[model samples]
Target chain A: MKQDVVIRTVCRLIVPFIQIFALYVIIHGASGTGGGFQGGVIFASAIILIGIAFGLPDALQRISEKTNTLLSCTGLYIYAGIGILCIIFGGNFLGYSFIPLPLDSAATRGLMAEIVEIGIGITVMAVMTSIFYDIAVKEDM
Target chain B: MIWEFNFALFLFLILCAIAAITVRNLLSAVVILSVYSLIMAVLWAEMNAVDVSFTEAAVGAGITTLLFIATLSRTTRRSED
Candidate 1:
């Protein structure tokens, strides 16, 4: 059997740490300036690393192009819904202060920020994965 | 002025970009692009954007290089000279 045939133990060590670090950036964006886009890219990077060390065909087995496409569309919908809910409540779009959630106080702003970050993460990760798939399959689109 | 740093990064970006374009060697081009990213990352950090630097390192250094190699392998090694 080939040494690289099995999933490398090094990947198990590295991937989790990268993911947790990405989350740290996403949640702590208020003062630090890192946000959903950056965190999402990093998260996608981790998955991509696995894709590289393993193989494209195997990676696709887990992430599939269809799933990536679905996530890409769903992320935008989530972001748009936040704005729609704000407007429905008689507030300006993205006026996150008006979001009617269980949370109260300035925490609401944090809540809105975090949600938007998550949306960004979803879109970036999904889109990036699709980009990899596209290039891998060599489908001109 | 921020222009100073911008100019430095721009210079590296341009030179590497030209190398990637003009040279027939695909691998060298990819390597030069990695250097370009490193320079750009440094510029971002100088501008007090640690987050952008982090992202640039991950995307530019890690993923972009990987993509290039993978794509390059799918094609031929030698380019039309």
Candidate 2:
């Protein structure tokens, strides 16, 4: 897609703010509404926007396949890692009570929720970008 | 935050849905579908689902429109029926 230079410039400016807001959602999920799945998809949109206006080559240049894989895994593992931490702390598997944060158990739950959101965001970003790339690579017209 | 503002968005989506399915021209229908997606995105945002609203705006309004446009190239732009 050959976007006008002005359109491309505008998208470049706007998309990063979208990403930042997505991160804000992910972080504040416990305090507000939307959790992991929702925040994740939003964060992914930033990259997708870049792909839309600038094309896949430019988008991919910024976010490599390797980084995508790593982040996707990291997001999921953050969730899993907590379970492992709970077990190591001699508590039930995935139990939030075992968390040793400075705050109360309720606050700990909030922290855990944020961590999982981050993980979900990474995975969503990667998978959605993959979808965009697949579309971009379709057979000739 | 804006309950009255959201009522307008809801009405917009309903209108888009009606236009999408009721249109005679296939290309026009497809374009309406994209509009429906955008309206749906706005509705989601009004409901405070920023995450979902964002995705809907990006995918529904953005990618899905492209998909419909691309498909339009290969398919007939009007229903024969």
Candidate 3:
């Protein structure tokens, strides 16, 4: 695919802003309307925009299959690990207050929720990008 | 909720939905579907469902349209029936 200067330039200019907004959505999810899933989808859309403007090879180089797989796994681990940590602390699964934190119970729960949101954001971003790559790439036999 | 705005949006929504299904060109269909999604997002927001509106804007209009376009590129552009 021939790269157009207009599309490429616009994509480069906007990708950063898109990613930042996605992070904002994820971080503000506890108190606001957006959440991890929405943020992750937005982030993935940025990568997809890059792919559309710069070609699949360039996008893949930026985020290779191996890295994508690793990220998805790591996000899931973070989510489950926190849940198990709460269990070990004699609280129900994902009971954020049970974790031995220096902060008050409400603060601890809030912090844990934030971490969970981050985990979810990471997983969704990686998985969505992976899905796009799988669908977009042509199989050369 | 403004009834006039809601009525106009619903009219456009129906038109887009019909156009999306009836259009023979797959690309046009995808685009119309994206437009439909955009209008739906506005309606969701008008109804005070901001979260759903955001999701519709992002996933429905943005990612889903791109995916459909990608799929169209991989297949034929015109529909047989």
Which predicted model would earn the best DockQ?
A: 3
Give the Å error, residue A53, model 2: 1.5
Model 1's alpha-carbon lDDT is: 0.79
* Comparing 2 and 3 on TM-score, the stronger one: 3
lDDT of 2 by residue, A22-137 (tens): 77777777677656665666666677778768876787898877778787788778878987898998888778778888899988876776776777777877776666666565
For model 2 chain A, where is the 10-residue window of minimal lDDT? Answer: A132-141
For every prediction, compared with the true complex, DockQ reads: 0.53, 0.26, 0.89
TM-score of each: 0.82, 0.74, 0.97
lDDT of 3 at A69: 99
User: What docking grade does candidate 2 earn?
Assistant: acceptable
Write one digit per residue (lDDT tens) for candidate 2, span B12-77.
888989888888998888788888888887777777777677667666776567656655655677
Q: Candidate 1 regions off by >4 Å?
A: A1-7, A101-105, A138-141, B1-18
Q: RMSD of candidate 2 to the true fold?
A: 4.0
Query: How much native contact recovery, as a fraction, does model 1 achieve?
Result: 0.55
| C-alpha lDDT of all candidate models, in order | 0.79, 0.75, 0.93
| Order of quality (DockQ) | 3, 1, 2
Give the Å error, residue A139, model 1.
Answer: 12
In candidate 2 the C-alpha lDDT for residue A140 amounts to 36
lDDT of 1 by residue, B1-81 (tens): 478768877888889878877877888888888888888888788888887897898789877987897688678877877
Which residue pairs show collisions in model 1? Answer: none
